[model samples]
Target: MDITVAEALVRCLEQEKVEIVFGYPGGAILPVYDALNHTSIRHILVRHEQGAAHAADGYARVTGKVGVCMATSGPGATNLVTGIANAYMDSIPMIIITGQVATSQVGTDAFQEVDITGITLPITKHNFLVKDPAKLPVIVKKAFLIAATGRPGPVLIDLPKDIAQARIKFKYPKTVELTGYKPTYRGHPSMVQQAAGLIMSSERPVIYAGGGVRISNAAPELLQLAETISAPVTHTLMGLGCFPGNHPLFLGMLGLHGTRYANQAVTECDCLIAVGARFDDRVVTKVSGFAPSAKIIHIDIDPAEIGKNVRINLPIVGDVKNVLGAILPLLKKKENGAWVARVQQLKKDYALRYDRGGMLKPQYVLEKLNEFKDDDAIVVTDVGQHQMWAALYMRFKEPRSFLSSGGLGAMGFCLPAAVGAKLGAPHRTVIVVIGDGGIQMTMQELGTAAEQKLPLKIFVLNNQRLGMVRQLQEFYCEKRYFGVDFQFNLDFTALGRLYGMEGYTVETEEQLLEILPRVLTSPEGVIVNCIVDPEENVYPMVLNGSPINEAID
Candidate 1:
């Protein structure tokens, strides 16, 4: 039976089991939008193109599915650039379906026309510009396959308006054959054995795990390896919630703003097993000084990342789950009580403890929040001092519970990400911890949350300044703060009301203790404006050009 290309596209999405699509419609994409209404696939109308992209990214991260998003050509497509780049940087799987100008007008600079595929080429894993209606199913199948396999990333499929309006007999491809594409899943036995030998022999060993552990669902395997060797484990920002935050073997996070003891443990360990983690600069401040005494064993699916940043003593190129599975049998359970005792001593000495200072301290705010929330609650944050504070204070026990822009560190990510997270996991309590400066960047998304009637607990850390940049200026720029302070004092709570949300501001601990619980447990969509101290800063920070172990508290 012949069908419209738009119908073919929608049917293919149903075949892929796509239940939801976040998008914004435009003049060029009206045909696809019309077909969309005939289908059962729920479409979320977003306030801006960026929100759609970010929401999709968040959904993908939580569900481990290929998140789908759509936009019209030209400016609409360009607006998705930031969110797409964010997903690419973090290795999140996403499929972006964009509406394009007619195929004949590809190079004519027609109204609302831009070569979106060309624009996103550098960031996307792969992209397709479809001119033929018959090839729609195949392109979409290929796009999803490429997006979810190997090292995951976003893929784009641009459909021209004329192509969408064309009619053709559609058949979804059973499977795709690509000679150039293959992901290595089974790690070499010899390499796994070598890694096992290092783990069993080393007196003081540490496991440095990253986001890949969560991606491959290798948390159980990671725990098995750590427990078998009686070794302590530290995580990267993206690696949070992979291991229990309160686990005895946990060493908190490592690198800049990382726990002092975790960095010390890495510096002093005789062996280091890096599982599914790339040694980014934030983690390894000075390459020469990172894990200098350790014989590093790197396990990752991506071969290019093996030696891109730090030197590797042993490289195992395979899925973390498969590689860890192979190594578990050869590993011996070690009763290294002395090393365990040492780890305990380090943690005890450097525990995160703060004194009552300013009335509206950010740490105190987060610490109290951690106390009030349940273990299963989801906490999302924007990039700032508030994010660092949340990382230091919140206790995460489950994977995908804590969402943030780890690689990209995008400022205005929390609000839209929280929207996606809540929609994706409706049963879980979703709270967005954002800063005042970051809030204004994409505060328009509040309208979306309100319109959707989403019960979002938005905690705005209102310091009235770009807190991180101000702190940087204090240390490096002779305290000459510029373009950081917000003297106008925009009312966040009032703005939330305009967006049909319940709003409140807490300026003191008394107000917080009385009001925070109400906001956290509130059934309605609400925004809590927390008036925090402007002078606050994230501590245990490494000075520029310093070793990871050398940090200034």
Candidate 2:
């Protein structure tokens, strides 16, 4: 039976069991929008295209699926760039569908037309431009398959208006056969054995976990291996929630804003097992000097990332879940309790603790939030001081309860991400913690939240400055504030009212104590404008370009 390409596209998505979609309609996308009304898939209309993309990311992070988002060409597609790049850096699975101008008007720069395929080439794992209606099903199927497979990333499909309107036979293939798209799933047995051998021989061993553990759902395997070998575990920004934060075997996060004890443990270990993580500069300040005394065993799904940054003594290329599964059986079962004890002592000595200096601290805010909410609630954050605060303070009891822009560290991720997260899990409490600067970047999403009636709680840390940059300037620039001072005075209450949201600002700890409870109980989403100390810095920060241990508090 012949059908419109638009019908085939929606049918394919339905076949794949896509329940939620985030998108914005436009002139070039009218045909697809028309088809959208015929499908049972729930569509969220975001106020801005960027919100749609971030919402998709949030959904994918929580559900462990390829998040789907749609937008029109030109400015609409370009707006999604930040969110797509954010997902790419974090290895999140995302499938983006954008509507382009008619085939004849592509290069002529027709109204609301842009070359999104070219713009997103480097960032996406793979992309396709569907000028032919017959290719729609194959391209979409392949795109989702590529996005959700090993070493996940975003995939884009640009459909011309003519193609969407054209008629074609609809056949949703259950399996896709793409010669150029096979992902590495099994680890080399020899390489896995070599890594196990190193673990057996080393006196002081540590496992540095990253976002890959969560992406591959290898947290259980990782915990089991760490327990069997008695090795201390340290995490990158994205590695949180993979291991329990309060676990004695877990040595908190490591990086520019990493805890002092975690950094010291990484620097002092004799052998390092890097699992599902890239040695980005943020984590390894001095690339050459990082783990100078340790033999590095790198395991990842993508072969290109094996030695791209830090040199690996043993490299295992495969899916993290698969690699960890294979290596567990080969590992020589032994206990190194002394090494684990040593890390525990380090953590106790240099524990992350802060005093509530009369002002409402972001840490206190997160803690109180936890006290009020359940484990099923989802937490999202934008990058900066607030991001670190959420990581350090928020306790994620479940695997997929936390979402943020870990790799890209994008500023305006929280608000839009919460929109998607709420759509994915409507019954769960979705909270967004963002710095003032980051919040302002995409504050327009408040309109989307209001319109969709998504119960998303947003906490804005109104410090009146870029707190993270100011921290850097204070340590490295001899306390020179420079361009870091942001004087924009935004009235959160007024802004929330403008977007038809309930807003409250807490300047003192007592105010927080009184207002937070009320907001938590409110059925409609609420906003907390938390006033914090602008001069405060994220402690135990590894100075830029220096080793993790060389940090200034």
Candidate 3:
């Protein structure tokens, strides 16, 4: 049937079963926004364009769908760069739409005009500039497919104002044809068999999980394979929610700040079944020293990632879920009791611990936040001390329960992410745990929450400094707090008020106890600014190029 290009865009998205999109409106993008009102797809109006992009990213990370965001040209599109690049680094699946000047005004530097496609090219999986109204359906369909399939990442689509208003016949293609976009879903039979043989015959085995597991929804299959052979599971920071944190087989987080046991367990394993996880530098301190004796079997959706960082003895180029499913039945149910015992012993020896102090600690805030959270509540976080604390303190029971910028480690991720999480899981409570530095970076998302009437509980851990950088300075820069301390304090309460959200500051534990309940009870959005010690740092951090035992206390 005949439809406007803007309608066709929405139609294509709807056909893909996209339930929600995050965006901000502008003059150039008014056509798309106008068309949005006619579609069933839920639009989350973010406070800033950057927030919209991050909100889309958070939604995609949790739901395993191609999250979508929109913005106008020039500054609006430029603002999305950080979020888009953040998605690019983390391999998130997202489709970012931006408005451009009319076809006649292209390249003339018209008001609010920018070459968004050109700017985002390197950061995206692929990009398109739609000058033709007829290409809307195919481009939208292609964008979603490319963003979600294989090594997922952000894709940009720039639409000229005239194009969005132009009429077109809507037709969603059943299949996409892109020569460079081919993704392998089946592992080479020989490689799969080799991996299975290695696992069955090995004396010790460990499954290393990452964000890819969650992205590919391979948790069930991964668990099945681990249980089939009774192997232990170690997770990367991004992999936190993929496996139940409380599960006995789970070895908790492993990385720069990973537990000593988790690090040593992988190091000592005879066979490493790396599923949906690349051996990032953070996880493997010294590449030559990491799992030196273990035979590596790498299964990933992206073939390039298999040997990018670490050499793989057996490489399976396919989705983690599909590969694991194929090899599960072939795996021998061997009784490696000694190996399991050793892992458990190591875990007991080096369990995660934090010293309780007089001042309010980020870890304490996280532990207490856990108390108020339901099994279904969605928690989003930005990078820094708070993110790690949430990872360490929060026990995620279900997949997709946690969302954060694990790969990119974006500082200003939580606020708008909370908005997206709320939209994705409307009935569930969406909480954003962010540090003071992170909150201020993308504080505009508060306006998004207020405009949309999203009832999100935002906890800003106000330390008045860049906590992570300060910690880095302590260890690496000899405690030089250059550009790390926020001497010119930003009143978060006033900022929240500017965004039209109720704001409260808590200085004491009693204040937190007294105010958080009141904040949550309210139907409108609220920001609880918790004052924390500026000097506080996340402890047990493994120094760069050092062993797990060399962790900063």
Clashes of each: 0, 0, 0
Best by lDDT: 1
Per-residue CA lDDT of candidate 1, range 185-283, in tens? Answer: 889888888888888889999999999998998999999999999999999988988889889999988999898999989998989999999999999
Alpha-carbon lDDT, every model: 0.89, 0.86, 0.84
Model 3 root-mean-square deviation:
2.2
Runs of candidate 1 exceeding 4 Å displacement: none
C-alpha RMSD of candidate 2: 1.8
In the order shown, the candidates' Cα RMSDs to the true structure are 1.1, 1.8, 2.2
- Model 1 scores a TM of 0.98
- What's the CA error at residue 396 for candidate 1, in Å? 0.6
For TM-score, candidate 1 versus 2, the one ahead is 1
Candidate 2 Cα misplacement greater than 4 A, ranges: 498-500
lDDT of 2 by residue, 1-553 (tens): 8988988889988988999889999977778889989678989888889889998999999888889999988898999999899999999899999999999998997898899999999989988999889889988989898998878999999999999999999887778788776678889888888888898898889899988899889999999888888888888878888887667787878877788888888888999999999998888988876888999999888999999999889999988989999989987777777777788889888888888776677778878887776667788888898888777767765567888898778888889888888877888888888888888888888888888888678888888888888877887789988887776678887787777778888888788889877787688778788888776667777766788888776
Tens digits of lDDT, candidate 3, 1-553: 6788988888788898988888888988899999889678988777788898999988787667788999998999999999999899889899999999899999998998888888888899999999778878888888888888888999999999999999987778897688777899998888888889999999889889988788778888888887888889988887887888778889888778877788788888889988888888878877777787899999998888978988889999998888888898787677689998998898898887766667777777788888777777788988998888788788887778888887678888888888777877778888888888888788777777777778888889888888888888988998777998877987777877777778888877777777766676577677788888777777668878775545655
* lDDT for position 416 in model 3: 80
**368, model 1: CA deviation in Å?**
1.3
